[model samples]
Target: MTVLKKLPIVSAVFRKVWLQIAVLLVILIGNILLDLMPAQKEDIHGYTLYKRWAAFLGIFAVTWILVRVVSVLRASSVMGSRLAPNISALLFTSLRILIFVLGSLIALDSIGISITPLLASLGVGSIAVGLALQDTLSNLFSGFYLYVDRPIAAGDWVRLENGMEGQVGRIGWRSTHLLSSENTVIIPNSKLSNSSVLNFNLPFPTASFNLVFSVSYQADLDRVEDTVRAAAESALRDKSDLSAGTAPIIRFTKFNETSVELTLILKARSFPDQSELRHEVIKRIRKAFRQEENLGLDPQRIFRLVSNQSDLV
Candidate 1:
């Protein structure tokens, strides 16, 4: 039954592939025929006009085939698996334009048109244009590197070293779009490439949340650990955002003059889930502490004793 339902999609894909192959074959045959045609006696710029026209046609046909082949390869999983879809499409487009330009230049040169002056002028103009658009080009190349290196991708939750964190909306030519909690942040690709990025979605969707708090030194250590563990377990069981496979961990990290600092490490399904999971865990732990005997004092408050000197004065 499932096979029958998917048959139409498979057949459609096969049909499209066959059509592309037929077009490519036609282009090749046309190029072959153009090569076989006789050159006329009429000359343009010391070259046979018929030969020039035929060469131009042949170049166009070959360029068309190259573009078509690349487009087909890019559309298949073979290329798409290695590169992001957007990046792959961009590369294919640039490849097509490059092939077309080179072919056109070759055809023009074949017709006895001197390309030396044109090449020199293009070189000078390109340098000037490149200088004017230095920043833009930097971003463009950075964006290309980001797509190739793949430090982060669309829909991945990432945090920059500067404390900006969000889910990536898109990776553009000049900038990367991030959909943060309050607004969208447009970060230049060059800056992103230079900065340190923490991708929470990489390797896996599960993320760990660390919650630090201090307990009074007077409190029982074993009881505190048990209470915190129970609270975390309750949070995991009651909240849908928390990961059920990994158990909550409690660690005694530091001992201050007044209190013992502890950390509660919990697992969430994703970065966004951390907030809710932390909230629920903190609430549960606070409630548990309040209900327990002799464990609800503020850990930050310090007590001081001063001797009275008024009698001596």
Candidate 2:
């Protein structure tokens, strides 16, 4: 059709939603009124074929309206944190497909179409498609689970069970992108979903973790506590990268083979946000302990610390 001829048809279908509703209403109302007019079947095919078609058209219109509402919600819900906006988008699209399928089936059935053959063909086709794309579909559904369970999100620092640790770049339909210090890691959603992931940036950004250090056996316990606590408090107050949590506290936990172990609770703004912060805190504490000769390490520098409780930290 030429532009001029298409204008009327386009306006009727693509105008505001209320116009579509009005059109559907007119079709339904006119069909009802026609049925009541008591025309003989021999007079017009309008009594059978056309009437069924009109009812089918009405059903399809309502289906379109419902899918439109879902589309609007999907667009407006983009700002939901951690729920992966694209995942919501996929969800709405799936819902729209489902509505279209059901509406088409209902409309066809209303017009005396047999659905048995259609259903059998669909079942066979779906099985073939599923078998061919097993891995792809597995990843897709796993992405859906990630959206619902919310194990991680963009910008989170996560360590996967397979030993890939990084900031999440994005969670895509087929895979998740993670940017580490070394490289960007792309994980298939299926593996990520099944494996354990350690999220370092949850509940609070600046959460506390234990830092352990060893001191000489002869060090004064009382003075040691005061010195350590003073160092921790000073580091937290003066450092911008540290302390979004409780004030630092020191605890004399155990006696090791050669030295006394003390645990200091330290906070960070975010996981791996700064290696410099750890270095800075240790440097400050070491400088402070230099004045207190008794708090020095047995044979080496005083600040022999472990990070967040790995072996050497």
Candidate 3:
């Protein structure tokens, strides 16, 4: 009773299920010790044998209970429920399996059971499983590396090698799920691990985009520049979703066959918004240029057609 009073509660619970096993082990040990006792007392076929076996069983039960007490504390410290409830079952099951395997091996050895054959069989099975899941293992390891390195995460807008632009929806162990404007794409972790990935939503959320606006050569260069600048400023000011930072840049880049090429650079929240902003700014600039008569026809229409002497014939 005093021993029970000092015993751990966790160990007491486990002993309920393992008490019989502990009894069997104790009996085996006591029988061997009895054979070494004095010749008269060593009579293994009497009530003395039962008494000795009972004492052994008691010791075995107490020891097993102590071990379970330690296991409970260890398991509590590493409980998956503290991290995530959904994964708690997996964590607990794995821990219990480990405890069972180790405890069984130790208990078996105490009872004189050989473990070499069991270990050899386990090793062979492990090798076979490794060979069968080589590719899956690679992807699993790669996924762990990716999570640790964190090159990309969920909600990041990325551009894949295949020219597909999408937001990373999830980082799965075997595949990365992406949600694009057109559809959802599943990219294998193997491919993502080896290929290039462009994550646009990291370091900063906004980026610069370019818009090319070609004007007729006959148009007034000065007025076109001012008009384009106003259009760009208006576009940025009108959007409540876009963040304000640098001013829009309007520059004359080159002279083409029939028009003057002007480039407008502006910052956008993301790739999708960039295209919309560019189109809005261009539309405004074209409207403003058309309203003002000073901005004349494009060079493509203003060119004079000349014929050679062969046309006179």
Clashes of 3: 2
Worst 10 residues of 2 by lDDT: 304-313
**Candidate 2: segments with Cα more than 4 A from true spot:** 1-15, 38-45, 77-83, 294-313
What is the lDDT for 159 in model 1?
90
Score every model by TM-score. 0.73, 0.81, 0.62
lDDT of 1 by residue, 90-158 (tens): 788898788877777786787788888888998999899999999999998999999879899899999
Which pairs, if any, clash in model 2?
Answer: 307-313
User: Which wins on lDDT, candidate 2 or candidate 3?
Assistant: 2
Model 3 per-residue lDDT tens digits across residues 236-305: 7887376235688778889888877777678777655666766676667666655654545443343221
Stretches of candidate 3 above 4 Å error? 1-112, 215-220, 243-245, 254-260, 294-313
Evaluate all candidate structures by whole-model CA lDDT and list the values in order: 0.74, 0.74, 0.65
Preferred candidate (TM-score higher): 1 or 3: 1
Worst 10 residues of 1 by lDDT: 304-313
TM-score, cand. 2: 0.81
Question: What is the C-alpha lDDT profile of model 2 across 1-313, one tens digit per residue?
Answer: 4663656433333443676698798997887777677558447655777778888888888888777766655544333342456786677789999999988998999899998899999999999999999999999999988877888988898788778888999999999999999899899999999999988777655545667788767667777678778877777777765556457768888888877888876666777744555566677677677766554443254345544452111
